[model samples]
Target: MKKIVLTSFALVGLLISTSCGNNKKEAEKVEVEKEQVTPTETESTEKETSESSTIVAIAAANENFTTLVAAVKAADLVETLNSAGPFTVFAPLNDAFGKLPEGTLDGLLKPESKETLTSILTYHVVSGEFKAADVVKAINDNNGSFVITTVQGGNLTASLDGDSVILTDSKGNKSKVVLTDVDASNGVIHAIDTVVMP
Candidate 1:
């Protein structure tokens, strides 16, 4: 009888010990998994941000420009825009296109109006890189204003007041810089609210 009781107690002890061992192993495994996964998640986030910047650069590239794509191709300015020489383009968003009068975009797309289209598009481009800071400095040094010569030989004058950058074209058209400092490998882009016609 005594031997049987001892065996029963030993069996219970063994079962309890086995259960505790399993629990400890499971807890350790969970901690190890979390540690292993943490760095991967952080790296993934960094990779995504890097990829987003690249996509922005590619999309801002002249060939893939949203509003300017058709016009660039129509005017055969793709090669010029994609060349090695860096350029700072005052890019107009699609909504800026909507601001134009009806039939304006269509009229420009016609083959007969190629010269006009090219000039207008080129007016948005400068020969070299000009960041917002440079523009602001030039404007301040020139009595609150500075004039830039476009690649098309047209003139674009800008004024800096407070935090806003205001632009005026040779045709007496005015535009506002809505967004700025979109970086690219080749150059940079400043998103303007209006399209300045040459």
Candidate 2:
């Protein structure tokens, strides 16, 4: 059988409904360099004590994920990402969110847009853990492409771009995975260059 990963979280689907159409507007190619920064050893270890943290913590600690962290809060998904049982999150960096058309971000952040925002965020998440190597293997095993079902009931197509993993969202937007295998106590995060629409 071809390798295809499909995980349906009925409970998660119950929590989110309705996708925002406005987010489908043509997006600019965000400059990833502006979003990521080299972490110094001291800042990297912020605390001398060794304590396992969750995905939310890892994202909150990194300046590159500021926008993502805020969106999680806005969507009230901080607790979900903090939970156990390894999730695979295609996290978009700050500049990725910046790529959205004008007013799109602000509109999604509004209280009225919570449902749409929740669906959009969850669309970037997969139920189980999938490392970069795992994704690559699955794609190659499935004849250069694999379709992954998101928690939101939307599908994301995973394929290869040279050595990189590319995710094509429901809206046909493509995001290149720039950073992968960011392990957390709860899950792993792969940073992407664009915000994939649901």
lDDT measured at residue 69 in model 2 versus the true structure, 0 to 100? 92
Residues 1-198 of candidate 2 have per-residue lDDT tens digits of: 122322345434544442222233222223333244435455567532223378888899999999999999999998788777589999999999999999999999999999999999999999999999999999999999999999999999999989999999988989999999998876789999999998
* Residues 1-198 of candidate 1: C-alpha lDDT, one tens digit per residue: 999999999999999999999999999999999999999999999766554444234554544257677777789886676655477888777777778999999999999999999999889988888889999989989998899999999899999757989889887888888877777545667888789988
TM-score of every candidate: 0.67, 0.74
Please report how far candidate 2 places residue 61 from its true position, in Å: 0.2
Taking all chains together, the TM-score of candidate 2 against the true structure is 0.74
Clashes of 2: 0
For candidate 1, what is the total of clashing residue pairs?
Answer: 0
Residue 95 of model 2, lDDT score: 95
Best by lDDT: 2
Highest TM-score: give the candidate number: 2
Residue pairs that clash (backbone atoms under 3 angstroms), model 2: none
lDDT at position 159, candidate 1: 97
Q: What is the lDDT of residue 40 in candidate 1?
A: 100
